[model samples]
Target chain A: MMEQPNRGRANIVGNGSVGGGAYTSVRIVGEGEVLGALGCDTFTCTGNCTVFGPVRAGLFKQRGDVTVKGEWSGGHLKTLGQLTIEGSVRAAKLDIVGQLTAREFVETDNLKLQGAIEVNGLVNADQADIRLYGPSRVNEIGGGRIHVRLSRLTAMKEWLKPRHSTELSAALIEGDDIHLEHTRADIVRGNRIHIGAGCVIGRVEYSQSLHVARSAKIGEEVQL
Target chain B: MEQELISKKDLLEQMDISYGQLYRWKRKRLIPEEWFIRKSTFTGQETFFPKPLIIARIGHILQFKDDLSLDELAGTLSPLQTDIRIGAEELRMRGLVSEQMILRHAGLALDSGQLPFDQAFYLYVAEHMSQLLRGEITEQETGALVRLLRGQLPKLEGKLCELVALRTESGSSMVLHTGGGRLYADERTTIAASIHLDEAIEAFKKKLYAY
Candidate 1:
C-alpha cells in the first residue's frame, strides 16, 4: 500500500514540473537550462528525480535513491538513497541516508550525509564530513571531526587574492599555535596538524602537536 | 547645504510603526532596512535623508548597541572588533577537538554570515546567545533558544532554521558523541563547531562577563 502524506498543506510556487504523492512522491527536473519547476505541497517519490527549477514541498519524501543530475535550489532535498548531483545543490539541510556524490558543487546549511561524499569542484558546508577529491570551501564544521586527505589548506583570506599577490605562488599563514599535517601544499600557518602526515609546510607558526614523520623533511626554522 | 534630522517618534509615525516592532528595535537596538533616521524638527517637509549616511550609521549603531548612547555607538564601532574569538578552553568545551570541526561548523558560521534578517533579530539572538552560552546552559554539546527563555534572558521563540538552528559547543567540556560518525581529532588545536539545531536547546549563552 502507498503512503499518504499530510494534506491541507500544499504549495507550488514559481515555474516547474512536479509529481507523486505526499508519502511516496517524486518531484524532479531534468535539464539545468530549464527555468520552470516541479512543485508539490507534499511530495513522495520512490523511483527517480531530475529537477532544474525551484522545489517547495511541505513534506517531501522518497524511497529509492534520487539522482539530482542538474542543479537544485529549494527549501529541502531529503532522500533515502545515494544522491548523485552534478550541479549545485542548495538547501537548508540536504539529508541523504545514502552516499552523496557531487561532481560539481554542493552547498547547504546543515548536511547529514551517511555515505562518503566526493566533490570534484567546490563543496561548501556549514558542518559536513566530506571526501573531497578536488577544491573545496568549508565555512565551519559543527561536529569538528573531519577526514580529509588533501595536499594543502589554503587560507581563504589569502586565496581571495587582492589581485595584487601575483608573485605569491601560494599563501602561507604565519602565527602561533598553528599546525599543518598530512598535506601536499608548501605552506603552513597557525597550529598545524597530524592528519595525512609527511607534508612540506612553507613555515610553522605555533604547533603544539607538530609531528614530522621520517618521510617528511623541513628546510626552515621551527619558530618565528 | 542643509541637513534634515527627524525625531524617532515622528519617523515611526511616518513609517506607520507598530508598537511591538518599535519596542523590539529599541530594546535590541536593531535597525532594519528603514535604518535609524536622525530626525530633528525643522518646519514640516518630510525627507528620506541621505541614504548612504544612514546606512553607514546603521553599521555603527549595530556595534554600539552595548552603549545606549548614539555617540558611544559611533566612537566604538570598529570593523576590527567584529572578529570571533574562540579561546582554547571554549574550543574544547564544545567537543570540537577533531578534524571535521572546521568543515562542519563552517556552514553554520557562513549561514549566519548570510542571515540578512533584520538587525533586531540579530541583536536579540547575539545578546541572548552571549548570556546563555556564557552562564546559563550547563553543557556545550547542543543549545536552543527555548533554554534561554527559561533562564534570565527572554525567549526568542522563532524557527531560525527549518531542520536545524544555530548551534555551538563552546561551553561544555564533556566528550560528545555526535550521535553518528567519528571525527578526526588532534589533541592540541581543535576548534569547536557550532550546529544549527531545530528549535533545539541551542543559540543562547550568557554575554561573556564584563572584563
Candidate 2:
C-alpha cells in the first residue's frame, strides 16, 4: 500500500510501503520502504525496510534488514539484523548485531557492534566495543576507548564463506586506550595500545604503554 | 614607499615551513592573494610576499596551528565579525585582562555592576590589557591605545584580514599592523599573549554556530 506524506503517526503492516514524507512515529511490520526523506520521533521496523533519503529520528530500532541511502541522525539506534547506511550517521548510542555497513563516518557517544561491520569513513565514539564475526573493514577508527576482538563464530563462518577473510583491515586506528585482535592497520596511535594475536600493523605510536602479542607483526613502535 | 619583498624560497627557508603548508594556508585564505607577488627572475617566475607581513603571519599560524584546527585558525586570521560576551567577574577570574584597568582606560564603570561586554568592548579590553601587562605604559599611551583599538575594532567587523607583526632589526621593538592600522611596542611587550583573542573568538563562534 502507498500513502502520501504523513504527519502524526504511521504503521505499515505486511508488505506495505510509504512515499517520502514526515512522520511523528513510524512502525513498519514485515517488508516496507520509504522513498524519500523521513523525519520522525520514533521509528521501529521489525522486518525489511529501505529509506532512500535522509532520516532524522529521536529513536530508531530495527529487528530485520534496513537500508538508509542518505545521512541519518537519531538519539538512539539499535539494530538486530543487517543494517546498511550509505551516508554518515550521528547518534547518541548505537548498538548493532548481526551485520552492519556504513559507507561514511559514524559518530556516536557509545557504540557496541556484534558480528561483522564495514565502514568506509571514520568511526568516532566515546567508547566502542566491537566483536568481529567475518571480514570487517574500516578506514579509520578514533575514540576515547576502543576494544575489538574476533568472535568465536569466525571459524564457522570462514568455513561457510571461503572467499572472504575473517580479519579486520583498517588504515588508521587512534584512541586514548585501544586493544585489538585479528586486525590489520597501517598506523595505530593512542595513549595506551595493545595489539593482540593475529594482527599486523605498520606503525604504533603510543604515549604511555604498548603491548604486542607474540603472534602480532608490527613494523615500528614509537613512544611519544 | 617601496615595500620590502621576500622571495618564496627565502620565506620558506627562513620560516622553516614546507611548501605544502604554505600553499594549503594560501588556499584556505589565511594568507591574502595579493600577498603572493609574482615576478620574473633569473630562475623563472618567482612568488614573493611583503617581508614583514608574511613573516608575522607565518609565525602566528605556526604558534596556534596545534591548538586550533586549520579552519578555526583561518577564522582567527580573518577579521570575521564576532559577538563575544563575558561577565565582569568571569573576566576577572579568567585573568584574561585586568578589570581595574578596563574600568580606568576603557571608561567602563565598575559601579554599573557586572554587565556583559560586547565583542568590540571585550576585544578592546583584551588587547590593551595584554599590552599593559607587558610593561609600564604612560597614561597617555594607554588612552591612545584604547582610542586606537576602539576606532579599529568596529571597522574590522565582517572583514577578512590578518594581524601581522614585524620585529625591528635590533629586536628591541615590534610593529603590529592589522586592518590598515599599526601599533608599535618595545621589547618588553609580549605579543604571544595576544593569542587569547584568537582562542576567545573561536570559542564564541563555536557557541554561536552550534546547532
For lDDT, the strongest prediction is 2
The alpha-carbon deviation from the true structure for residue A214 of candidate 1, after best TM-score superposition, in angstroms, is: 6.5
Sum up the clashes in candidate 2.
0
User: Across residues A96-174, which tens digit of lDDT does each residue of candidate 1 receive?
Assistant: 6555666555555456554345455434344443322233332112111223332222233334642212111113322
Q: Per-prediction DockQ, in order?
A: 0.02, 0.03
Off by over 4 Å in 1: A1-36, A40-44, A52-64, A74-76, A96-99, A131-192, A197-224, B1-211
All candidates: CA RMSD (Å) = 24.6, 17.0
Q: Which stretches of candidate 2 lie over 4 Å from their true place?
A: A1-6, A155-164, B1-211
lDDT of 2 by residue, A53-111 (tens): 99888999999999999988878999999999989888889999988899898877788
* Worst lDDT 10-window in candidate 2 chain A: A1-10
> Per-residue lDDT for B1-211 in model 2, tens only?
2456898757766897644466456645687656777687653345678775677678888988999987788877555422123345544445445666566664652334443334334444444444634644445545655565556655656543333323344332222244544455667654432323454555643332222
What is candidate 2's TM-score for chain A?
0.91
